[model samples]
Target: MGEKTLPQAGQRGAIPEKQAWKALAALCIGLFVTLLDQSLVAVSLPRIREELGASINQVVWVSAIYLLTFAVPLLITGRLGDRYGQRNIYLIGMAIFTLAAFACSQAPTIEWLILLRAVQGFGGSLINPQPLSIIHRIFAHNRRGAATGVWSAVASSAGLFGPVIGGVLVGTVGWRWVFFVYVPLGLISLVMVARYVPKLPTGTSRIDLLSGLVSLIAVLAVVFSLQQGPELGWTWWVWVVLALGVAALLLFIRMQRNNPRALVPLGLFKYRNFSLGAFAVGMLGFTVYSVNLPIMLYLQVGQGMRAETAGLMLVPMGVISVIMAPVLGRLTDKIAPGLISKIGFSAMIAAMTLFGILMHLQVTPAWLLIAIVLLGLANAMCWSPNSTISMRDLPPELVGAGSGVYNTARQVGAVVGAAALGAVMQMGVDSFSFGAAMGNALLLPVVFLLAGLLAVSRFK
Candidate 1:
């Protein structure tokens, strides 16, 4: 199969490997800038709060709203890449994100910031799934792992690197600079995409607008209820909204199963690796997003570390991930992903659990670094293999749908993680020592990672 010629979407013959890789690099820059921009925002949260006079709850919305908006539109956006050209869709989304970043920096209040972040999230959703489609279209099935590895490396490393860059921006300039810092990177990504990424052929798949709206409402309801439950005292209305969200979600699933224009083609889940990959990545999303703000808050507010120092403390995560992704990415092409992901999930579980334990105990700060290192290792192993395993087997026509579903799972996990953690942290802070509150909140990710581990354990 590797020996057979596979043409690019608009070509007569095989797309040169060099051209495929160059296009992937262009996509990586866009992914990296967005992830870096978002992750860096965590380090700036305290500063954002101080300047805007936002309550801790309002602060959580800055992150949660982004994830919620980002997650809900993804299925549609994935199809957008299929129906319109990936490069064209990517350019439009990147333009929106860059403009929104500038708008976010200019926001005078927390409400404004939150609103702008939503626009930014929607833009990110458009950007996220294109790489999946383009990579699959351009790379052969057997070699997809290596291409995916490069993509995953940028994605994972960007999140890790965000804090370090964010700390510097926050410490020297201000919180607004964190958003401002990305404008140039975004512009550069736009230029590179224009220069490198090819215009792939669009598919005939029609998007299901009704299903999209239903899915959005379901996600918004659940995330809103979780985020506001503590503030609202978990009132009757909160439970009502939560229940409605669950019911609506079930309805959406049923709708997809029957609807020909389904946002998620339920049939795709029939592939075991695809199903497990989506599940595992969701757990990863839950853990990764849930842990960030709490750790930043714990270190900055609880331990009183300087923003730059605290950001620097977490740099090892990105550093380790960057060093290991290429190696592990290649490994996914040869080895059993089940074994690789097991090692990753175990490390993640240990790291988050240990973080909670030590934070609850208020142990010395140095001890926490060990957990960070584990997280880095977990990130390196989890992203590439899971991504490689998930979509490589799909028919080319289904790549966009598969990517959308896979990424939606991830962002949905992120949405739940951020919301649930916010609620937990708010409760913990009220009743316990700050460190203990953060420590307890860390356990949520453990439960998520454990679930993911069990899912991947069934992989062939």
Candidate 2:
């Protein structure tokens, strides 16, 4: 089969092999940073609380606020990239992220740290969407699986190592250095993108700033309401804020449907695959991040594991995921994506069920460690294949939008999972049992997997 060709920027010729590799490397770094940030704070949360004198709620925002900021702007940013140029947006985002990391390191108060995390989220929003855009522009369909496989593998493995690395850094250097770790990586990634990322101009439209603003308001209100509801007793004002948020979202959707220069073209949803795939991605993202945060708590706080030891215990899962993700991604391209997705989801179910049962029984450390490793293997298969399958069916024109849309699900899920599961465990709603809270959280992945199975079954 011949390589598929897409239009290039400035009427340039075909993308060269070296340029594609460079773009991939830059993209991998961006993906790694985003995923790393997702879990890197887990081990350090206690330290941050002690140093910053953060309350339970304030500390959660250190994580939740970042996710809310990240998730809310993705679709808008993706569209902005299309309108203003992805390379420029990506470069700007990296710079912002780097600075935000520095700010986070210097933060002396929990509020300051939370604010900096929000800044990091915004920067992350810019960085995360462009990689898929680059992949769509540069790689032919025949090569996309291998290319994206590598991308997915790098991203998934980052989650495995991020906490471990954060743990060690907190134990040795300080928790602040976790934020600083991105500086050198960001600098290197910036150079790669500047040289290799093609500078495609905005086609015709300016960024629909009004639409972006509305989205920001809506998501922020909703996320804030959700995050605070459990603690605040879900008062009338919380409900009011949430209701207003829903209304704003509805209004935003209406605006997008009617606007000539919509931030995200409403028509993208016409693709059955894109719609269903995005849903699956969202649910999967929620389950994945949810698993990371509480598990860290269980290991460190519940079991009294040292930061370094916890980090070491997580290594097997990282290794397994790193090895398995690419393999599953490659499999996604050939055998039915749904079948692969189903298998992956099934693995997730097994992993979560085992985890809940083992933790409930207060199993021995050796056995518990084994369970965590198995969970990693299951996650490896689920995450990569699911990501590959979700994006595979998009038209070239829709690729950039698809990237943003897909990631939005991931981020939103992370926020929701963290907030929702945290509430359950902290409030003792899940039987005052950490194991029960975990079991309840595991149900989310099961539901998402079932939905993925249905999506795959309906595949044309």
Candidate 3:
């Protein structure tokens, strides 16, 4: 009765181990693409600007558009996966992403490239939620941290290599190869999804189209305002967009109360751990996206490093995160998750503070390398275990919707963080000392790290 009700496959009450690894592999592919997309663009941005004759605003938009689109659709798509089928939705997203990559590579104009990038973001939104949703369905609770740890490792490893790979491709072959490079990997993943990614039966609830609309409007308005505010000088549109977004959010919450099949189930937040854990994940997302772009810009412009060289500098951080996540996940089961998360948050704070000091002194390669190592270790500590704790106590039926909400928060936070940080750096370009903008950006991560520590306190 438990096995039948649980939606997990067990032979006379024992979950099979082989299927777990298969799910992990499929998830790794999805994560690799997502993380790779974020980092690969870092080193390639300058080249992209030069070839396409893009201004600083347009260049930044390349990253911005991707993140904004990526964040918006995650909740809706995740629920759609639960309702339609995780396997099917995931495959469709991958197909769209792979083909979109080709379109991005061939784009003859900057406008065309940006447009395609928006399309790419939409496709990406579908990818992030399904893998974790699949994991939640397949893995039993006791072993989930270990599973998430492996998934986190793959994500970090891909993030680590993306810049290096993008740098090399941009320097030797051309920026076009950055997009073209994902082709074979996508093809392989498509095959894997077809063969290994199992399909759950479609759910019965009707799609909540209105709720999805309000959510999207709210998210887009806020994202646009934040991204454009520094550049636009607090225009009416900024205020209007933000106000509309806030209003839309209120409406979304009101609608969710009545809609039985809401995109994000409000009831999931009734669980204290789940609510706090989701907020912490959002803060972590804020830290990562906020930190990454500025560091990339500084590496290339301020430090006088080539795209590839700067990318290689980030290698240590990526490597440590990849190596530590799974190991830490396994340890989480034996130890308390809150302790693990506290340690992780502490590491991140230390890394960010040290990075601030290093940037103030000089933007040297050695300093960057040391900071990367610390950042990677910190990332490994926070993400995997925090994710484990986030969903630890939820009912099985709620996992899919919960994964959607959790992922949506993460994606939305990343978008907001990137926008805010980008604005700070731009303002820093004019208002403060040489290092002021970068230093100001560090405040974001510090605040998030503190918040994470506070949230982890509630984990048990």
TM-score per candidate, in order?
0.91, 0.90, 0.92
* Shift of residue 135 alpha carbon in model 3, Å: 0.5
Q: In candidate 2, which residue ranges exceed 4 Å CA deviation? A: 1-14, 53-56, 108-111, 427-444
Error of 3 at 306 (Å): 3.1
lDDT of 2 by residue, 373-402 (tens): 777777766677666666765665566777
Worst 10 residues of 3 by lDDT: 1-10
lDDT of 3 by residue, 1-460 (tens): 1112234532221235576677578767876887689878766788899999999889888877887888777768878787777777788888888898889999998899999999888888887788877776677667778888887677556656776888788889999898888778888888877766666555538778989999889888877787667778988878998899899989988998956877777888898878988998888878875686667667777777776677778878878898899999888767975888889889889888887777767657576677788889988998888888888667656767888888877766766677677777777879866565676676657876788789888887
Candidates sorted by lDDT, best first: 1, 3, 2
Q: Give candidate 1's TM-score.
A: 0.91
Per-prediction tally of clashes: 0, 0, 0
User: Which runs in model 1 stand beyond 4 Å of their true positions?
Assistant: 1-14, 49-61, 108-112, 429-432
lDDT of 2 at 258: 69
Error of 3 at 241 (Å): 0.5
Pitting candidate 2 against candidate 3, the one with the higher lDDT is 3
